[model samples]
Target: MNLLLVVAAVLAYTVSAQQCSTPRVRSEWSQLTQEQKGLYVRAIAALAAKPASNQYANPDIMGWHDFVITHAREAYWAHGNAQFYPYHRAMMWQFEQAMIATGIWPSNMGVPYFDWPAMSQNWWTSDLFTEQYLGNMNSNDPDHCVLTGPFAKGKYQVAFDVDNRRAITSGDTTCLRRNAVQAAGDDATAIANSMNAGSFAQFTSSTSGSYYDTTNYHSTGHFIFGGEGGDMSNASVSPNDPIFWLHHGYVDKYWWRWQNQCEQFLYDYSGTLMSANDPNGNGIDAKASADQYTASWPFKVQQLLNTQGGDPLCYTYSKSAGDIPLAPLTCPPVVKPSVAPTTAPPATATGGAAATSASRQGSQLDDKWLYTALNLLVKQKPLGSWGNAPKTGATAAGGIQAADAGDVVVFGRRDLNETESFNGTLEVASATVQADETITGTIAATIQATATVMATTSAAVSEPIKKEQNAYIETINPDNSTTISYTLSNNTIEIPAGFTVYSVMPISATAINETSGKPKRFFPEIPKLEYVQHAEAPVNVEVGSHPCHLAYPILLPESYIESMGMNYNKYFNAHVRSKMQIDAFNADNCTTMFSPSSMMNFNSL
Candidate 1:
């Protein structure tokens, strides 16, 4: 016999004076007076808005769902708390209404009916809500409700007969009350179990089969029920399935109940679930995992569950009919603060201070050399581009440009204002001597590079260039004993050998305020150089006319010289092809202009 047929047969055997209730449209129509009905409605609404991903969709949350379902079933059977039945019934009705309101259900689709026995079977098959129930029941064969009964092997067996009807209409008063108490006990156990298994950590990794992968009804169903399941977009779903809402309402009910039972639970409400990208959909803040609920909402799950018909949280309801309101129920007061403030500073501060001090002291070595090194590092480790190519001999831009060699290029003057006490300088100059002439130039004559200091009071500090004396550079070359010199004036630094210079200006300076006496600072124009072959004239006296070789000094501004330090060739190569294409290359086929071997040769040069 079919499992459904067997369960139906058993259901027919038990008859009650009270009929299964219909859902109420408004709060006043419920059998339980008006107030209890209001509480039920509020609880349902709270469950609808549960944090679908984090604590709710967790396996622990699923366990709670099962526990709640089991208890609700148990309560219905044992004491016929009729009150609890209406809450769930009303919840289902509201959920269906929402589905209709949101157009999730077809227009022609009549309202779904809730057959508790069928629902019980559905829960038994679900991966998210079956663990606890499975432990006590025989799920392999739906015909048998008993795990170890004589009739377990056949359909319409006696095992199903006992469990389906014993608690509901049994004359034994002790058994009837025990059922309700046991149901509550199961609920408590599930909550404790769920609390112990906090936050789902699976979403943090790169695993492909997580619950975040789909947006189908199954996934949505799991989300509402707080169960563990894959994305719902599986191809096997049908159009007229009734299990979706039954499962979702149960899930929602758990959240509602959890809100009431645990103060910590209400404060911890958060949304960290991933959903399909929809522009108008609620955005999931991954960092919100750390945030806790603090705002006072109009209703909370806890107060809704506990309030009676006369209280502000109350509403009336009956299992045979929907909700009725006796008095108007007001929303619950919002909880203010969720997180606790620190009484003392964290221990990491001391460690961080030591690290910072060490770094600053290390940076104080010759600023030019340090700048050059940082420029190289920056070039090799470019995070993003700085826009259009810089023009030659332009004003010094104030942003630092790093090189692949960990060198930094700084451009500008090198003097400090009276308010600031730093005055650092690097001076260089050169003089040429003919082959037969005596070398008669002092070291001071070689000091041809100079940087002037300027101070500014401005609001925009990131404009890229500021008039501060922060860098200097000079170059000198000897060609057949003739010296060629490259120099810089007050606002610029000559670029050294094998360097490319770029300038950045600061947006504005913060040290210069309205009350400060300093004028607004501006960067001076910078000169850039490119090395070209320079040939010396032929000397007629020696042999026929031997060509004299000449070596010209290349003068680059401070910023351009710093660009030579870093090696960014590797980073440039990495982004050229897909990962598969890169993996496909071998020593033979991979010999291209930008290949690893060629890049190494370029770096060496």
Candidate 2:
């Protein structure tokens, strides 16, 4: 079945097709004029009154809303993994096409996208929810159903979670339920991180994870708005929410922004190629492309990849600037240390948060003076391994004894403060120097600035930056350039040979000063893996949610076989191919779709 859709799409976008230039701009709901909003409502009403295609079991589609419900039913396979962006883009376009077909939509009007990230704080409560628009939260119904909306109870009866559930093999109708959830999931820093991610792999790795934090962009919106059992929470039926279209608009906009960053991003396709095995022997199984995606219109992943092409999806975003907050990174220049004035050489840059204090007794102090040349990697000062230490330095830190006992302090011949000149005792430390109060609340603000910038909603560093236990505190060098610390083990940690523990990198003074120079939003990057603490519990969405007749997926009518005078079972592949071509060939009336014998719903004659 997937191949059928791909073939249709390949034929639809012939080489001669015009590249979209005067593309319509999709804007926020609040930004729309009264006329536009009214057209949407009217179009919706017309679609509702139109007969439900009966492609699936529910014959009571009340109008265009059923298309939205049909999409909600298929929500299971729409998200998670990679095709999420492309799959949904195709789906929304189909929904728009349905509205347009009903003649309710204005010629220039495209589906409006809600710019959640771009809105001022507490956007859900905005005027976009007015009775003239999508309506407000229900005061009488505990499910938070919408009241006073055009689709209100008598105005429009819902059949599933909102209007229905995924499996609608029987009778089930309900009112539209909505709880406008205040989403603070993606803050400026996190969204900025996602937008600036270096590669698609990096972007995918970071965004699709299970970690629901303040930085997540796509899924977090669902979790934030879709409170327990709310229609938006369940992927199988999230489409029940009217605002779903708008939210996906923002998502599609993000893809557009990322794609326009560079031409190479146009072909950047990762994740799975084929979505599921075709239930229809005709080989029409769903692909990551468009078929079951939204009416399964002949749109492939590549066609939607770039919105500029005139191929069916020819819309553009009015505002390319993502609502994401910008957080800039600045790495300062490195400064070399001057030699010691006294006989003692510069103290080695020690390891742990707070390095051990200078030795008090002369013999122990002499032993401390013994040091070995440090091994350096391109980025880190590798304090992991060490060799024989030879006696070198003589001078000792002038600081008094009785340092914090519980704390590990590194005392050397001399340490250098940002202000103080080097060659003497410097109180240098690793994470703890920055960890005492830098808890989970502060973790998102401090991801490593230098690592591969994958925009992950990684569940890794989900835990707050509380005090890490059983970590290593090494006092390796005497130079104050930088210090390295490691996470040794947990309470049950058993150190294995050759196992490199997690490293803690302290920021350099120059870098710190450079970050502090401007607006003073200092984000020092930590270990990349350190951010991903765990894996999210995977939820595999079912292929087909409910029973259907036509087997056209979302495209064909039930009587396609008898009315077209063909044995659908005998030449299923050929029949499907012809139907696809016929649908595109005749954009209006969808005549070939409706078989006179198959038409049973009262809405359609």
Candidate 3:
């Protein structure tokens, strides 16, 4: 009886010690006491000090901030994809575990979140960012390093840019940096509207900031804190920042608000499962596999859907939207028709002089672009090699340009950006042709190319939220050159869901805002080609009715990509396409590029 009584007392004491006093009301920065704040900072710094666990010390693993980037990087999933909410929620939870293990976080404490709107006007001046606190902004540092934050000043050393693979440890031993620049798409009105969005896609897109839809808070935080060399902006080391947890605490609140606020979407859940490291590669996985997409966590996505029921239901935060007001519930539902119209084509015809066909009318290529005519020269054959055309006096433009003695011209030149049809039907009516007798031979020719023009636009356009379907075709030609491309079949930018225009605004005296909605010029003029429309068949002198040679060009353009500084061929499928293209490639299995109800963020942060 005496031993039993003693055991009961110990059990009671242990329970009392571990009672998580409150659910996650993660206090705002101003509410935390000096000790609480310092503990949080030091705890994260302590975790940063330890080498990654041997199990996770792989070269691809970077910093204490591994799981999120790992899934987003190696698994090639998460972020803007439909898994945005659940995946990040789990990521934050995992991060909290690390802090707990560090023995610095107060027992049973909650991670705090920053109220951007409340501090928007004077965020930088707050003591939360002083040399004694999180640290001053990196603006004063010439090397673009964060040297004043509490975690800076030798208080901690952490990894940076681990997503770059080769950078797992390269130059990682440095202070974090912050640019204090306003991330674009963070307007108050936009924020409120996004909060009011009806679907998961809409909500995720808005939060995607300028990179996806029309939201701001989440995006604004990333760029503002991670400008230049700041870890926040760098997806690889974003978690290294002490502020990362607090910032994401608010982001998690956004999800909870969408669900419980008036319970508008209490049981709502709808989105496609995309591939990423899943053995199946890139498509909808079987239910067993799909349910397990919580990155490297022990739990699944469904467990994260309900804050009140998840294993232990650890914490919660204030639902009051604070200074960044919640958007009105009246905002429109997110939708994308398979076919949305683009701008009309230019009227004046030049180059290959493509007849102005009304069927090809859609989005307009920027008029400022020097519309260089596109020329497709196919290698025709007398069995194995080209031997020039029939030398027949064929009429092309001013004069028929002769193919080098061993080549055959299929489609003549024209401004691909302006004249290339979105339908992709550059066809030749007949394969039979009467070329100079010497070049007589039948050849089955299929030359398909999809060209999408991505550039720094005239207006800062923000449409990164829509996760598009995969639109690509990869086929080897006899010449050994591989043609991999993203065909822009139904890539239409509908207003609201597919369009955004904004100008940068001043958030604070020290904060230099860089709004993406504002106009900015892009490089490489024409980044790459995206699509081809089905229309009038291509026309050129058909070679002899022979089927000796098979040739086609997909033209994703590796040369141009390198010239523009994009590591195009990082891997067989290391996606270097536009933000949407990359997302589409990972989501869909190289099929039609249409629309997905969920979000596939490009990690634009």
Candidate 4:
């Protein structure tokens, strides 16, 4: 049979029992009174609270569709025939319940149910399901058409996409039906196989295996449809897919569990995608992208992760006890070195002569030195300037050790005297030292100062005989002649010369006195020097011999300017040739330079 006919046949078979009753319409469901919603809430709660043993203990739990049938049967049994309805009717009733609870009263809810035959003859045909499905797809507004009322309203409508191939609002009925069939098929297989496969332990262990490996829609979508192959060809895929509600219930359950378990998990949920939209049709993303969606059933995912039976979410046929807790995994501790010391070292020689006398014999020094040495060797330094050895009696072999300089220390010090006076002169022990001199010995220098004795002659004691003032005359050096007009006052010297001046010497007193005594101020003993040359200027000289012909300026070769014309001519010729080739190719006058012609030729060859 063709795909559509096959789908029609399946739908017909599925709804055959309730063929006389009018199909429940979501619009009609929205008009139910408040009393109906309360009743629904209670019924659903009671149904949720029912023990698994009361529901799936029979030998017939086979496929996902069958499981769903079994669950509906349980709900029927719990609520009685008056309180329940056929698949479509029950959904309509629930919608009413949700509407009343949400304070929305759609106009169609109060309309009485018309017989299927009568309704089919009316303006609204029994094919309302098909029409609605097709209409929702073409509307390009899945959230508005599919998730119309309270139960599926609010944030829940956000993720719905009319354009999605897998979306309910997408008009691809074939794919949807196929998906439903596959889902129902899988659930049915898992259920039927689990029955013959011994206890719940065997079934759960096998089914739960590798389930968490992927987060793809297919992996999750399978469960969403039902345990096995769900019937997607039906218009009631949303409410008819019994597994959807159960799975979501469990998601809610996990939320409650997370509240008690993962402390950090508590917060406003957020994400890039929204579960629903507002009236203006804008997305409402989650508050936190990492927020987890959990099942709302009485049992948690943690409880279900290792469990196959006994929990509220599991069927009673499951044989395992669900109360046992799983063992938690932990990491190992890290280890570090301890602070202790243990050994001693051999004695070393004392200082040489003139040094304070020190005994080198068997002196009982603490093992502090050994600890200190080990620390210094390891950390590469002493603990402080005062050089802390280990505690007094700590033996090198005892493991008690001093900290190295790099080792952190906690101590304090205060300056006792800031200005205790002491004077000493520094002297060089030896001269012409190639390397830097390292003074090792201690020294103490003494300094004494006295006024010079003045002769007090009896020659009329001439006005206290003040010392004759002395002065010197200096001549400028040849090199320094450029700076002849410089000035010297006190110790400060000034030179206006652009170049740097190295050193200057003072004239001798005897030379100055002789110069002053002579009429022309001549000093014969003094050197007749010009400017002192501090350093010699560098000489620039060319090396190697040049060809005689190349050396003569008059016979020099043509300059670079002459070569320029030749270069330009070569460049212009190349450009002209390229332009000619391009123009020929453009004109289709020649095919050699064109890629299309070349490719054609190559192919032919």
The lDDT of model 3 is 0.38
Worst 10 residues of 4 by lDDT: 446-455
Arrange candidates, best lDDT first.
3, 2, 1, 4
lDDT of 2 by residue, 461-564 (tens): 33322222233232222222222233432212121111112222121001111111110011122222212111321122122221211111111222322222
lDDT against the true structure, per candidate, is: 0.22, 0.38, 0.38, 0.21
Q: Per-residue lDDT for 53 in model 4? A: 22
lDDT of 4 by residue, 208-260 (tens): 10111111111223232322222221112332322243233322222222222
Clash count for candidate 4 is 56
Of 2 and 4, the candidate ahead on lDDT is 2
Q: Judged by TM-score, which candidate is best?
A: 3
Model 3 C-alpha lDDT per residue in residues 1-605, reported as the tens digit of each score: 13332222222212211233355556777778998888887876676766653222111112364543344233223443455667677667656655665767764666777765443333555676787677766656554566666566455665433333213223545656565553222322223334555765555542211122113355457656666556676554566666777778878877776765444353444443332212112212311222343544333454566565433245766543353334346433433223222243334332121211111111133211111101111223311111112222221101122322222112211211211111111111121223332221121111111111111211243442221224323322233222222253312111121111110111000000122111111111123334332133222212222121101111223432331112232211212122223223233322321112111221211
Q: What is candidate 1's lDDT per residue for 1-605, written digit by digit as tens?
A: 13332222122212211221222222112123344433333333333323221111111111112222222222211111112222333334323333333323332222322222112112233321222211222233222122322112221111111112222232321110110000000111111222221321221111111111111111223222211111111111101012334443433333333344434433333222211011111111222232211111111122223223111122222121111111222233455334333232122212232232221111112232223222222322221111123322211222221122211111122121111111111210111111332222332232222211111111222333322233222222221111112122233222222221211111101111112111121122322222222133222122112121111111112221112111122112221221112122222222432233432322221
The root-mean-square deviation over C-alpha atoms between each candidate and the true structure, in angstroms, is 35.1, 29.8, 25.7, 44.1
The runs of at least 3 residues in candidate 4 whose Cα sits more than 4 Å from the true structure, single-residue gaps closed, are 1-218, 221-240, 268-271, 274-605
TM-score winner between candidates 2 and 4: 2
In angstroms, the error of model 1 at 148 is 32
